[model samples]
Target: MKSIVAVQFIAAVFFATAAHAEDLEFVLVNDSSSDLVEFNVSPASSGNWEGDLLDSGYLAPNYEVGVLIADGLQTCVYDIRGVFDDGSSVEDYSLDLCDLGEYTFLD
Candidate 1:
């Protein structure tokens, strides 16, 4: 019957909700000589840079922070940029988020 089919579909949806895939996550480690004022991440194939992930905040020197790639992200390779305290910035492109679980800005 139609009602029976609807009930079965509802049940299947409820049961499948718990089988979601693990989200991509990464840690940004600061190894540079100065503190990080801003950190940004975007798809490597894109031409323009997006907004700052830090907004008005910062990542201190010798510290690190975790970033989660939100669900529905289409690309795996990402570009990252970190602005140092001395007004200098570093950019890394074509880094795969799934492959590199952790990234460090070298001195």
Candidate 2:
């Protein structure tokens, strides 16, 4: 009986961790007229951009992209940077990922 209880407790802990991790992910929407040529997610506490989350591809205009904060960081706040094809950029700082399910990049 003790073993069973221990297993269930571990399972619950695992699920909670998974849910917390999922909360750090959000969808990035491009609300501008130009394509999103660049994108990145950085920890708010780091003061340095981790790297481009969009990799080599471009997020087209009026499209939505999924983004996840840096791995293994116990942070809910982050900085988002989006660059458009028209040489314009938008930057947001200290945004809570759990509070923002969908972020719209506007002009």
Candidate 3:
């Protein structure tokens, strides 16, 4: 039996993965059973969730995609939100993207 779960990882090994100082581009892995419908990334200090990074199609289970946080902000700390097809969502707070080369949403 499989259970839906959300896992967070932030290791020191990912510290130098970003291309540049301000670029927050990383690979998003959807390991959860449900399809990911929408993905949002916003500054940790802000109250509102930013635009959908997924844009159009949903990210199916076991699939992954590369996301570029083109906000152009110098800050690396941000909040992440992922909405699934089963009406369930996961939220991660104050993540330093510059140190995270990849993020996986587990099941």
Candidate 4:
């Protein structure tokens, strides 16, 4: 009976910790040239969860490409690489993100 009670208490604490986590969304764009391009965005380090936001062969024109990331209380560095469909490529760029809200790019 004592073992059963201790197990339940541990399980409750584990679930409670997992529930109060922060979720972040990462938004990337290719505001460089006027051509259709593909890119891959991933976390800089290992054991970091990069949530689902975009897919392969995704065309991110001179606009904003949004991606959603899992909830966590850690600084996440994203790697953005421009992958061209044809035999061409573009320069790599960096994005500054925060937990405020979405970013809007104006002309």
lDDT of 2 by residue, 1-107 (tens): 01111110000111223333543666677778898887877768776765555665677766775564536555678787888889999999999887888888887
Against the unseen true structure, what C-alpha lDDT does each candidate score? 0.66, 0.65, 0.75, 0.38
Summarize candidate 1's per-residue lDDT along 1-107 as a digit string, tens digits: 01111110000111122234444577777778887887777778678776676666776667777776553454578788889888999999999788887888877
Over 4 Å off in model 3, which ranges? 1-21
Model 4, C-alpha of 103: deviation from truth (Å): 8.6
lDDT of 3 by residue, 1-107 (tens): 23323332222212334444455678788889999998888889889987776665687798777777655566789899999999999999999988999889986
Q: Top model by TM-score, which number?
A: 3
Error of 3 at 92 (Å): 0.5
Q: By descending TM-score, how would the candidates be arranged?
A: 3, 2, 1, 4
Q: How does each model score on TM-score?
A: 0.74, 0.74, 0.78, 0.42
Which of 2 and 4 is the better model by lDDT? 2
Question: Which candidate, 1 or 3, has the higher lDDT?
Answer: 3
User: Which runs of model 2 end up more than 4 angstroms from their true locations?
Assistant: 1-23
Q: Model 1: how far is 52 from its true place, Å?
A: 0.8
Compute the lDDT for candidate 3: 0.75
Ranking by lDDT: 3, 1, 2, 4
